[model samples]
Target: MKTLYDVQQLLKKFNIYVYVGKRIWDIEVMALELDHLHQAQLITQDEFIQAKLVLTQQHRIEEQKNNGRDL
Candidate 1:
């Protein structure tokens, strides 16, 4: 089980950016790009895993807030 902190560290380790520009993009886009990179063999499985973890965490947090569970 990887925590958000772990995901952050992994991103830093690979020099991956979560939100570089202010186009208001979500994790799904990032996940898709990462998947494309994986398919192209540009990044390793570990990189993909870390990206997936971070993206999934972001999605979950957004959904929770939208549901008004904890604000």
Candidate 2:
């Protein structure tokens, strides 16, 4: 998917919803859930890869924002 929301929607199809209060934590959990889905062959390899890319980018952005706040 192209955005974090797209990834979330993909997970939602499997009834997976993650909210750990923090954005970074939520993203981390979503990644874990994606891994499980991929392992189970619930999603295609392409979908898995795209979702992961989205999560990684979002995670990096969150990290940068958090780092800026810490500074």
Candidate 3:
């Protein structure tokens, strides 16, 4: 998981599609779903870790951009 597209593809592989009109929200939901999959032993720890890293970094970058506009 290196980008939103990567996460989207990961979700797609499991037939888990979600769109909340915001990329960040979509990624967040995917993170939750990935967690469930991990808990269920459906996905590996490596996949979970990579997906989470991508989501967190992307979200943080977006947040920083939003904050920058307020200054």
Best by TM-score: 2
Write down the TM-score of every candidate: 0.60, 0.98, 0.86
Ranking by TM-score: 2, 3, 1
Model 2 segments more than 4 A misplaced: none
| Candidate 1 Cα errors over 4 Å, as ranges | 1-25, 69-71
Clashing pairs in 1: none
Would you give me the overall lDDT of model 3? 0.84
Q: What global local distance difference test value does model 1 have?
A: 0.64
- Alpha carbon lDDT of each predicted model: 0.64, 0.97, 0.84
Question: Which is better, 1 or 2, measured by lDDT?
Answer: 2
Q: For candidate 1, lDDT tens digit of each residue in 1-71?
A: 26545554544555766764522254555666667678878778887787687778777877777679555
Candidate 3 positional error at 46, Å? 0.6
Q: Candidate 3: how many backbone clashes?
A: 0
- Per-residue error for 21 in candidate 2, Å, reads 0.3
The alpha-carbon lDDT assigned to residue 35 of candidate 3 equals 89
lDDT of 3 by residue, 1-71 (tens): 67878878887888999898876677688789988888998888998899889989988987888789899
Model 3 regions more than 4 Å off = none
Any residue pairs clashing in model 3, and if so which? none
For candidate 1, the C-alpha RMSD (Å) to the true structure equals 4.5
